[model samples]
Target: MEEKCTTLGKLELEAQNWFVKVIVAEKTPIRFLRWRRQQRLVFVDKENERMQSIIYEQDVDQLDKLLELYKTYHVGNAKIREITGNTPILGTSKHQMILSRSTYIKRTEEHERIPIDHIYQFTPFSELPEIADVPTKQINLLFSVIHVFPPRFVERTKRNLQDFVIINEERRALILTLWEEFLQSEAPYLTKNVHTMPILISFALKF
Candidate 1:
């Protein structure tokens, strides 16, 4: 039984757990459409200001039933704030806050657990600093060419090869897999070479 309280009122949603919360708040002209799934939710507020909303989640089949109950009456707490685009925040305690930052993240693979190799020198983008500064949870980036292990030990397929990497320390650099278009259009920049390193790119959790 998960506690479901509404901002308009303090009510519990025990039977039905409606994860998607769409808030059309009173006195505000912003549109906030929110939905939660797979531990990820899409919160959108077209207006450029702090918007208010409500949301709750649990396990149930009759999500619509719970949602209708919420619309008819008032449940969970209100005040789901969407202050800016790409950056979402929600109020939990009286004084605490939660920040949802979308960033470029790479996952570790079984082979990546050990050291691999990758190409080092790259054609640095002039606008990289500015693009990195923008407050965004997700950014699109690509790698030119990465030196990798011979096909003997590593398994790679047509497009999957572009998806591979080897993260060496400062000794060499990590170049992530760029999309096929970037790889094809900018083919000359990342030419395949036997000397390049083969490794994976991963994120060291930030505190």
Candidate 2:
């Protein structure tokens, strides 16, 4: 019998096995925690619904090798659970997927069903004042880079921090901060073209 594919929005905690054919929308670098290494991948279903998934220390390497940005995959045998506590949940779905060594993940050919681009619901700069008052919610912003400051190494936190001045179509400006890994990977490019006014779309930004 063939496995039936399910959309991210249809996933429920009660289901032990989930079969999803989705595009790998976003992938993060492995984060080193005190006890374990972890990585996150955001998958987008045919409906354009996204869900965040975690690969713990054990499965990080294996899955990282298999998953790539904007690629389509058939996923199954992954555990689904409700997100709890302070962790900022991504997408419309409240539940998250957990992948392990036993999880079935196979990269498949790209199809028109799933979107290759990352999904973001951008909030206007004029509305930021109200949204800033609500700290619990994460929002997306679209802006142009007006300035990029030199990266600073913080001895106390052992992290690199960089700042960028951005503005929206209304010319309203705001300061954006980039921390740690983003400095090494994203800062240089933004800094190089800061004067050219590059358009930037930031996802999941919180006050």
Candidate closest to the true structure, highest lDDT? 2
Worst 10 residues of 2 by lDDT: 109-118
For candidate 2, the TM-score is: 0.82
Candidate 1 regions exceeding 4 Å error are 1-38, 48-57, 60-126, 130-207
lDDT of 1 by residue, 51-93 (tens): 2233233422223233221122222222233345543332121
Q: Tens digit of lDDT per residue, candidate 2, span 1-207? A: 025887888889867666888887767778876588999888887788889999998789988988887778888868888999877787678888898989888877544345655455678888888888786566788899998788888899998899999999888999999998687777888999988999977777765
> What global local distance difference test value does model 2 have?
0.81
TM-score of each: 0.21, 0.82
